[model samples]
Target chain A: MYKNILLAADGSNNALRAANEAIKIASLSNESVIDIVYVADYEKTKEDVLHASSADELMIERRKKIQNVEKALKDNNVSYKVTILHGLPGPEIIKYANERKMDIVVIGSRGLNSLQEMVIGSVSHKVMKRVYCPVLIVK
Target chain B: MQSLKQQWFGNVRGDILSGIVVALALIPEAIAFSIIAGVDPMVGLYASFCVAVIIAFVGGRPGMISAATGAMALLMVPLVRDHGVEYLLAATILTGIIQILFGIFKVAKIMKFIPNAVMIGFVNALAILIFMAQVPHFIGISNMTYVFVAITLVIVYTLPRFVKAIPAPLVALVILTAVAMFSGFELRTIGDLGNITQSLPSFLIPNVPFNFETLQIILPYSLALAIVGLLESLLTAQIVDDMTGTASNKNKEARGQGIANVVTGFFGGMAACAMIGQSVINIKSGGRGRLSSLVAGSFLMFLIIVLGDLVVKIPMSVLVGIMIMVSIGTFDWSSFKYLAKAPRTDAIVMLATVIIVVYTHDLSIGVLAGVLLSAIFFVVKISTLKVERKNSHYIVKGQLFFASTDGFIDYFKSTDINEKEITIDFSNSRIWDDSGVAALSKVKDMLRDEGIEAKVIGLDTSSQKVVQQLDGISSSH
Candidate 1:
């Protein structure tokens, strides 16, 4: 059941907890492997783009962030690889899971509050509402 | 603007399909409603001409068709009944003038008062009323043969989709009228009632029995017109939205309604509103932009002018068939069925409106009753706010939600005492119900007048111990 688990990482602590739990369960099964991924919201605009640093610097920082997670996985003696892509965060994450034939996808529910989720319409809510695959939204 | 220009014209196939359907649809509805308004069927056509034309050009929603509707027709009855057709025509003209004034004053924002439930109630009730009204036309067997009209209704309803481009009403009218005409069926036809004028509607003055008395009498009628007009147009605009995948500013459309009414009145026609049945037919038939509506109005006018005599020859059964179709189209069966299964309050309100409409022969009466009942329901729910009384202390909980706050204050004033010494422990409460706060403030003022110590103990104090402290007064959790 734990084999080929897709860990939806948002560089959040609780997502890390779920990721750690998935890795541990996978290592214990000895047949499971972890696929780490981050989904960027592609609909973000130029004004939004201005708020962030240049692409190369952002990629470098993302790499460092993954390394931190990788170190945590290593400390627990778990095995994994990472991928980063851009699109509507929830759908993209689920699409990646489906495309890669991963068993399950794990995500963090920290980005949006319920009211904002209702209005701006959260990716996780959309995923929960639309996606056929099983998704765990860690609080 | 670019998209508007690109899609504004063309779409001939959709337009023609919708146009023919609307034309067939409008003939019966326009005539029936006109009859209901105590006028010749052609006057209904004249109204269809004026409103459909003006609104087509000026309307915010491109595909929405404005024409005489049963709702407006029903409203016109009393006005026409008491004042006679001439005065009714004057009032109709004035109604349009008032609508135009509404537009010029930019009063479309006022339409927001009509809520979703009420709107749903309106359309659903209207659908029921339409079907009920058509009962006599379908049943060919006279002595109250709206039932045979029902059979013609059934055939028209069931056969239309399978037989494309052939409007159902026309089919029903032709087949049924032929049967009635040739078979010498003891059924009444439009010609039997009175001779429809072969002459086109003569331009008349806006001389609706004008006076303060007339205005006072017709105020509610006009208000009903305004409400029904606003609701139908707004809803039709929504349909147009779904068709074109575009959004319309409803308030703007309402302003357009006001302007259209004013113009229609200026032309000495009856009150007109957005015809949802025709509008839907128009859109689904491929009408886009204002062209279809304009074409429809122009065509209707052309028919009334050139083919008035032939139109008068169309049997009442055929017109009934057309109305039966319109009734089915406007009938919100799904919503009606859903409402039937809804809560007792909802069901009661809907049924009450329906009953009032049937009994009073007034749409406004039904709607007013429905609205009032809805208001009463809100007040009852508001008044039910939990008030825990413990000796000299009181704890108010739940939202002192708006529309309910005044009742809460009144309850305390009537039942409780000690204006100076009373404590309202709201510490356990999570929200300061806006209405509740206003009510509490009012209570505080009243207490001040009586020289009572009115103290608010737990308003917005998020301390968990406040709950325990309040419990000490009642000695219960």
Candidate 2:
């Protein structure tokens, strides 16, 4: 049932938990694929650039963060693929999942929740409803 | 009649047309909301009256009419259903009293905290929910029938092209009603539930026995009403402010709303809030002064007294049509589309709000979800806003506020982990508020936690002076 699992990482503790769970699930399955996705919310690059330190420098820093995740996967002895996508994190993850026909998705339950989540929306809830495959949201 | 220009009726041309437009719109909404709130439709009407009259006079923003809205209406359902109508009214009155206190205390400052992203998400989610909710009405079916879906789709696609200033929902209502009524097409109508009351509202409250259990039961409903009322009124004030290039006195409006709800409760009415449709209609028409809303309220009373039978005669189909149009107009589709292209957090927040609102029965849950999502977006958004490191120390000038604190932390922590000693060059920084102080304190804590040495420079002593002081204090050669 857990052939191809997608682990969502937002550099948050919960996402790491979900990642760990995905790795454990993969290890248990023995014949499964693990994929890590980090979505860089770069939609406001132009606005952020005006007040930001520097775009090139930020990208370098972001790449390094992703590389760290890659290193973590390597250390865990998990054969994994990492995708650093620039788009809405939830939708992008869902889109990637649907496109790949991933069997399951794991994410942190408490990733980046704020007051705006009350009136605005949450990514995990949206994915839980929209996605066809099973999704595990870990607190 | 008074002087030539002082006719009690005001300008009949635009006002009457706008009134009819507003009436057409309000009637169905009032009815739907009454059912949603689990109260007699008359309560909704009465609420619409009280809110319109009171806010018209005391409201901060002109062209912003207050009324019994679906958001507030839905909250009443559990209250009326669980505690009976009498207790619900008592809670409403208490809510009003609280609102007045909010006004006196000037609690409008809270509105500022409502982030723009959350606001947009809220409006967008409301738009989708309202649009979907009206599908059955648009297609000329009322009982969640499948036939209405095709009709709604066809009408949604084709009607806007043919219709102009006359709202499409009205057209849909007329056509559908004609098809249903004249052609004897099988469908449901408000007439099916019960006869539309032909009698005017008498000043009376049901004498159902009340208890603390009842009050406790209605607590959630009142809180829900308060949140919905606050959100709706503030949002409407914002819209009116945008339209008229005016600013809103939020605290005053909240107090005003509170007063209106209390009065409404006393009068056997449900919760009331600022009505976006009526306000826009008021502006689009010749409603210039508080008189417009006052007249709207008085007009409802007058109609109930003199033309109750005629009002009851107005087809539910017509009201449904007006609502369908309103639902369509209320939706911020373009922004919904734009949110798709926004930051992942924002997009996620918006989508989650829409889903929760659509699926859940409780309105507060959706709002709570949206707010939490927005907070996350704010944090992440602020985190991405970075500080530049100039020289050996990090120099950050400008307002070192809470909004930019995350970015500062991210930059400082990442940099300090690599650098041995660092100074936050804040001498040139303009500390706007205590939020800056809080951020600085946080940075201090983070440095201590990470076992790195960090200090604030250029405060009482200039950066150069601080360097000199440090050099003078150094015991090592």
How well does candidate 2 score on lDDT at residue A24?
A: 79
lDDT of 2 by residue, B225-314 (tens): 787788778777755554443355788789888888877887777878887766765655545445566667766666655655444433
Whole-model Cα lDDT of every candidate shown, in order:
0.66, 0.64
Clashes of each: 28, 29
TM-score of chain B, candidates 1 onward in order: 0.77, 0.73
What is the iRMS for every candidate structure? 18.8, 14.3
What docking class should model 1 receive? incorrect
Off by over 4 Å in 2: A1-139, B1-17, B131-182, B205-210, B301-321, B376-477
DockQ of each: 0.03, 0.01
